[model samples]
Target: MRIGLYPGTFDPVTLGHLDIIHRATVLVDRLVIGVAINRDKGPLFSLEERVTMIETECARISEETACEIVVHPFENLLIDCARDVGAGMIIRGLRAVADFEYEFQMVGMNRRLDASIETVFLMAEAQHQAIASKLVKEIARLGGNVAKFVTPEVRKALQARFGADC
Candidate 1:
C-alpha cells in the first residue's frame, strides 16, 4: 500500500493546507498529517490544541473515502518521523517561489538521508496561495474574522486561545 506523509507546523490547519490533504487523499491509501513541533518559531497553539484541531477537522473528511487521516504531533525531525511511519513519499504544498526554494532544499536533504523516499509538491489553489498558519494567527490577533480561511474547529480553538473579543 502507498502511504503519503504530509508534514507541516499546522498550528491551526488552514483551508489551503486542507486542500492539500484532500488532494493527498486521492494519491495514497493513507495520509499521515505530521504536525511538526516547531520549537524555534514557538507555536501559538499548544501541541495538544493543534492535535485536537487536526483530529476534529480530519475526522469530518468523509469516512467512505479511500484514504484515512492520521494526526501526529512530531518533534525532533521530519525524516525520522517519516521513517518511523514507513512513508516513502513526503507530500508538500507550494504556494509560491519562496516556498519552493525552501521545500526544494529540504527535499534534497531528505533524499540524501534516505534515497528511498521522495518529496511531492502540489500548487496551492489560486485563492488560498497566500493563506498560512502565520497569516491565520496575524489576522486573528488583529481581530480579523478568519472564519472562511480555516475550519470551524480551528476558529474555535483560536477564539479560545486569543479570547472571543480578539
Candidate 2:
C-alpha cells in the first residue's frame, strides 16, 4: 500500500489543511497526519486535542475517499516520523512563494537524510491559500470571526478557548 506522511503542528487544523488532506487521499492508500509536538512553538492545543481535531476532521474525508487516515503525535524528527509510519512520500501544503522558500530547504535536508522517501507539495486552493492556523488564532483571540478558516467544530473550540463573545 502507498502510504504518505503529512506533518504539521496543527495547533488548530484549518480549512487549508483539510484541503490538502482531502487531496492527498488520492495519492496514497493511507495518509498519516503527523501532529508534531513542537514545544518551542507553544501551540494553542495540546497533543491529544490536536490529534482529536485531526481525527474528527479527517474521518469524513477517509470515508468519502476510501483512504485510511491516521493521526500520530511525534516529538522526533519529521523524517524519522515518516519512517515510523512506513510513509514513502511526505506531503506538504504550499500557500505562497514564502512557503516554498522554506519548504525547498526542508526538502533538500530531508532528501539528504533519506533519499528513498520523496516529498510532494500541494498548493492550497485560492480561497484557502490565505488561511493559516496562526492567523486564525490571532483573529479569534481578537474577537474576529474565524468561520471562514475552520470547521464549525473547530470554530466552537476556538470560541471556547477565547470565550463566547470572541
Candidate 3:
C-alpha cells in the first residue's frame, strides 16, 4: 500500500491540516496523520486530547477518503515515527516561502534518515494557508472565534480544552 505520513504537532488540528488531509487522500492509498509530540514546545492540549481531535477530524471527511489518523506521541525524531508506521512518503503542507524554506531542510534531514522516504509538499487552499494550529490556539485562548480556522469537531475540542473561563 502507498502510505503517506502527514506529521505535525497539531495543537488543535486547524482547517489547514484538514485541507492538507483532504488533499493528501487523493495522492496516497492511505494517509496516516502523525501527531508528533514536540518535547520543546508545551502544547495547549494533552496528547490524548490531540489524538481525539485528530480522530474526530479525520472521520469528518467524507467516507470516500480512507484516511487513518494515528496519534503518535513520538518522543524520538520525526523520521523515526514515519519508519515505525511504515509510511513510504512524508507529506507536508506548504503555506508560503518561509514554510518551504523550513520544510526544505526538514525534507533533506528526513531523507538522510531513510533514503527511500520521499517528501511531497502540497499547497494549502488559499483560504487556509494562513491558518495554523498554534495561531488558532492563541486566537481561541484570547476569546477569538476560530470557527473559520477549524472544523466543528476541532472547535468543540478546543472549546473543551480551553473552556469558557479562558
Candidate 4:
C-alpha cells in the first residue's frame, strides 16, 4: 500500500490545509496528517487542540477521499515519524516560489535521512495559495473576519481565543 505522510504545525486547521489533505488522498492508499508538536514555534493552539481540529476537519471529508485519513501528533525529526508510520512517501504543499525553495531543501534532507522515502509536492489551488496559518491568526487577532479562510469550528476557536470582536 502507498502510505504517505503530510506533516505540519496545524495550530488551527485551515481550508488550505484541508485542500491539500483532500488532494493527497488520491495519491496514496493511506494519508497520515502528522501535526507537529513544535514548542519552539509557540503555536496559538495546544498540541491536543491542533490534533483535534485536524481530526474534526478531516472527518468532514473522509467519505469523499479515496484513501483512509489518519490524524497523528509527532515531535522531533519528521523523517523518523514517517518511518514509524510506514510512510513510503512524504507529501508537501507548495504555494509559491518561496515555499518551493524551503520545501526543496527539506526534501533533499529528508531524502538523505531515508533514501527509501520519497517526497511528493502538490501545488495548492490558486484560491488557497495565499492562505496561511500565520496570516489567518494575524487577521483574527486584529479583529478581522477569517470565516472564509478557515472552517466554522476553527473560526469559532479563533473568535474564542481572540475574543468575539474578531
On lDDT, the candidate that comes out on top is 2
Per-residue lDDT tens digits of candidate 4, residues 1-166?
9999999998778888999999999899899999998989999999988988988888867777757899878987999999999999999998899998898899889888899999998888999999999999999999999988898899999999988655
Error of 1 at 37 (Å): 1.3
Evaluate residue 41 in candidate 2 and report its C-alpha lDDT on the 0 to 100 scale: 100
Off by over 4 Å in 4: none
Candidate 2, run of 10 with poorest lDDT: 157-166
lDDT scores of the candidates, listed in order = 0.84, 0.95, 0.81, 0.90
**What TM-score number comes out for model 3?**
0.91
Best TM-score among the predictions, by candidate number: 2
* Displacement of the residue 70 alpha carbon in candidate 1, Å: 0.8
Each prediction's TM-score versus the true structure: 0.94, 0.99, 0.91, 0.97
Pick by lDDT: 2 or 4, better one: 2
* Candidate no. 2 TM-score: 0.99
**Weakest lDDT window of 10 consecutive positions for candidate 4:** 58-67
Q: Over the stretch 65-166, how does candidate 2's per-residue lDDT look in tens digits?
A: 999999999999899999999999999999999999999999999999999999999999999999999999999999999999999999999999999544
Residue 99 local lDDT, model 3: 91
Better of 2 and 3 by TM-score: 2
Q: Candidates 3 and 4: which is better by TM-score? A: 4
